[model samples]
Target: MDLTGYPTDFVADLGFPGAARRFLERRARHWPRLFLNGVPLDDTALGGWQLPEEPDTSESSILGFARDAAMEQHWEDEGYALDDTGEGPFALFYSRYGRPLRAGAITGVAGVPEQVAESVESIGLMLSGFFVVSLLTPDDPATDPFSESVLRDLRESFAE
Candidate 1:
């Protein structure tokens, strides 16, 4: 799909429960296949992306248990403190983790290095998620493009 017109700067108010689902559903009308962190997310993925309506009493009750579990574990491994916050799915995930990390995006064409593609895709998703989180949490400002603190951290990390 030609996602050249994808609105990277667009911010959706996904503060309420089920808002993410609705938003995704609406967007699917135009872009049926949405990519999050380089992974394809379609209608089937949406079912898994959402929080279950009921407790995990039976195995069948959980639609995307393994995928969700892996993702949660991945987030935890990446230093995010995934807590039981009563916020929307994306809002909850992005607000706590996305804001602090200040993720950004990049684009590449075919034949791009695997590592570069992965890094750029992940950064793009993080940045977009961060934008959504910022809208949900208006008091918390988004990271400045030319942040001295970030620059200092980079310099210190790279210093030998």
Candidate 2:
């Protein structure tokens, strides 16, 4: 995979090859759900992202639209529920976690629906599950786990 088009800031903050390896390790320990532009990597139409209740601290936040009971209710009311496991279309692109992170949205990457043969596929793997990148917005955000602080925490947690 070619990572030539991924965001420079993300690459700089979290070392690429190391970060990618770490992400794979993290995925092995838990479910695969990476954040990019505040939203998890999903092709579903009604996509939403989560944010921290307290932005000042480094602790993970549980605030999210889809995580809301109402949203779940709405989906249930419509007789639909979000899948709770496994990789979807881009499983091969994803690492051992068996999931694909959404690096397709970032600039320089190929557009969605386009065929990608050997792309390095960049994505923000939100390790905390409830945290998101503090730097970019949904409109112009990097992949999830974009938070350097949270990444440091993840490294420590994994080290233990």
Would you list the C-alpha lDDT of every candidate in the order shown? Answer: 0.32, 0.29
lDDT by residue for model 1 (65-138), tens = 11244443443343222223311111122221223224265455234578767766634433222222221211
List the candidates' TM-scores in order: 0.26, 0.20
Question: How large is the C-alpha RMSD of every model relative to the true structure?
Answer: 18.9, 18.1
Could you tell me the lDDT of residue 37 within candidate 1?
Answer: 38
**How much lDDT does candidate 2 score?**
0.29
Identify the leading candidate in terms of lDDT. 1
Regions of candidate 2 where Cα sits further than 4 Å from its true position = 1-9, 32-160
With candidate 2 superimposed using the best TM-score fit, by how many Å does residue 87's alpha carbon deviate from the native?
9.8
Specify the highest-TM-score model's number.
1
Residue-level lDDT tens digits of model 2 in 1-160? 2211111122222122243344434433343344322344443421332221233334422212222334334333432222232111111111112122333333454423444412424543332122232211111113433233334433443333
